[model samples]
Target chain A: MEDNGRTARKRAQILEAARPVFLRNGYVGASMDEVAALASVSKQTVYKHFTDKEQLFTSIIMDTTAQVEGLTKMITATLDDDGDLARDLRALARGFLGAIMEPELLRLRRLVMAEAERFPDLGRTWYERGFERSLKTLAAAFGRLGERGVLRLDDPELAAEHFVGLLLWIPVNKAMFRGGNDLYAEADLDRLAEAAAGAFLRAYASPDTA
Target chain B: MEDNGRTARKRAQILEAARPVFLRNGYVGASMDEVAALASVSKQTVYKHFTDKEQLFTSIIMDTTAQVEGLTKMITATLDDDGDLARDLRALARGFLGAIMEPELLRLRRLVMAEAERFPDLGRTWYERGFERSLKTLAAAFGRLGERGVLRLDDPELAAEHFVGLLLWIPVNKAMFRGGNDLYAEADLDRLAEAAAGAFLRAYASPDTA
Candidate 1:
């Protein structure tokens, strides 16, 4: 049992170190030697945890899907608030912007996309597990809102897509192309969240609900 | 006059050859020697037209911005039609989707974004000249529609952003991550365009306009 615990701890340490190395140098450019050095572990130990560089890169991306669990909870909690719908939506959007705009997340996103062509399965898995999971949760919340007569939409899933599209398209694209997250001021993000929520309500809100 | 014509012709030849080379190998991996060999021009001729690899890449990107002029014209022509507003908007959306979905253009977009960190100025120039120019034209078209009482919006630019966001957020991101443009069928694109136009009209169309 003690040996197993030590093995698990070493594996965790390798994963933690691999994230930054992958983020800094991308998949093709990152080296296993660097990861081993950064983790302060023997190179043999690093390979023991991850069979190869591709395995390590895949492991790191898969690990990030866990981060979205927090976002799922936030979406469910914020959208379920008893406050005004607009305020609730604004808060949700703010939460989303805040979560995605983390510098580490942004760099990871760029790295994933940069390598998407080379590693198609990694990109698809990340999209399905991390991106679509959040959308599905949001869609369920929107469906509940629709059923309660708070919103009027034929398709809650489509509405969910539009909600995120409106909020994320500009800033996310800017970040992707500019290679940084400092492009938007806090004031800018607030205005964007409000604009997206406002537009969403205009399109989907029931007259009585407003 | 003959010498100027020869210089212009050589420049065009070099650009035509450089596009494929850059697409196959990203900025860091692309080579000037390959460009010269592919252009059927001597290295001296290639250098005569472009100062360095960076200059060559920038010129390739800058040259593509002219393609947006075609989009601007299409927007004005399509939206200014005497046909039904919904039909016109759908057609415009369809055109927008078709234009951006070209395989070469998608590859170029990935290349620009991939190198964005290393070539901040090139990315900024591409965004301002190609991306923003199209959005500005769309905004102006939306403003004219507003003035004509067809659409109702206090901010045309925001409406334009929403229009594109609704239409493009899914497919563009998918392409960016999947590294292919075949993810969406033609029928899928038609459905997406119609949905976007439907949502935009719901949010911004004048009540009497419909």
Candidate 2:
């Protein structure tokens, strides 16, 4: 049991250390030597945990999909209740914006996109496991809301897509192209959240509630 | 006069050949030798036209901005008329979607985003010249529509942002992450365009017009 715990801790350390290296230098440029040095482990130990650089990078990306679970849970908890749909949506949008805009997350996203052509499977898996997974979860939650008379929608899935599209398109593109988080102030994101939620509500809220 | 025309033709040939090289190999991997060979020009000719790889790549990106001029013109022609607002918006959405989804443009977009960190200036310039330039033109058109009571909006810029956010968030992200054009069929994009336009009109159209 102790050996298992120690192995798990070392794996975590290597992943944590390797992430910045990949984010900084990209896939082809990243080196296992640097990852070992940053993790305070020998290169042999690094290779033992992950057989190759591809495995290590794929592991780091797959790990991020777990983070999306929190957002999915937030969707169910907030929207599947009787709370004001607009306010709940704003809160959800704020949460999503904040989550996606994390400096680390943004850098990881850029790295993945930069390497997508070279590593097509990595990009597709990340999309399915992280991006599309959240949208699917959000769609289910919206379906529930529609049933409860909180929203009106012909297709719950399309509504979920539009809700996020309305919220994330501008700021995310700005950040992706500019390559940093400083482009948007907290106030700017808040206003974006409010505006997106308002627009979404105008489009989806029940006629009586709107 | 003939000498100047010859110089211009050589410059255009080099730019055309260099684009695919950069797009295929990315900025770091692209070679000037391959560009010269592809263009049927000598290495000296390539250098005489553009001082370095960076200049060549930047020139190629800058050249694509002229394409956005067509879309902006379409926006005015479609939205500025006293025609049906929803139908016009769909046509505009279809035009915008078709333009952005061109296989070559998508590839260029991926290349620019992939290199954004290393070549921050290029990314910023492309975003400003290609992306924001179109949005700004669309915003001015929307503002005119608001004045003519075709649409109701307090902030035209925000309205424009919402407009694209609704339209582009899904398909663009899908294309960006998946690294190919075959993921979405033309019928799929047409349906997406229709959905986006319908939602945008619901959010912004005047009550009487809606």
DockQ of each: 0.69, 0.79
State residue B135's C-alpha deviation in candidate 1, in Å. 0.5
Residue A192 of model 1 has an lDDT of: 91
Model 2, B1-210: lDDT tens digits are 999999999999999899999989998899999999999999999999999988998999999999989989999999888888888999999999999989899888888888878888888989999989999999999999999888899999999999998889898888888776787788998899999999998899899888
Q: Candidate 2's residue-wise lDDT over A45-85, tens digit each?
A: 99999999999999999999999989889888988777877
Error of 2 at B18 (Å): 0.8
> All candidates' lDDT scores?
0.88, 0.90
Candidate 1 residue A26 C-alpha distance from true site, Å: 2.5
- iRMS of every model, one decimal? 1.1, 1.0
Where model 2 places Cα greater than 4 Å from the true spot, the runs are none
After superposition, candidate 1 runs with Cα above 4 Å error? none
lDDT, candidate 1, at B18: 96
Classify candidate 2 by CAPRI docking class. medium
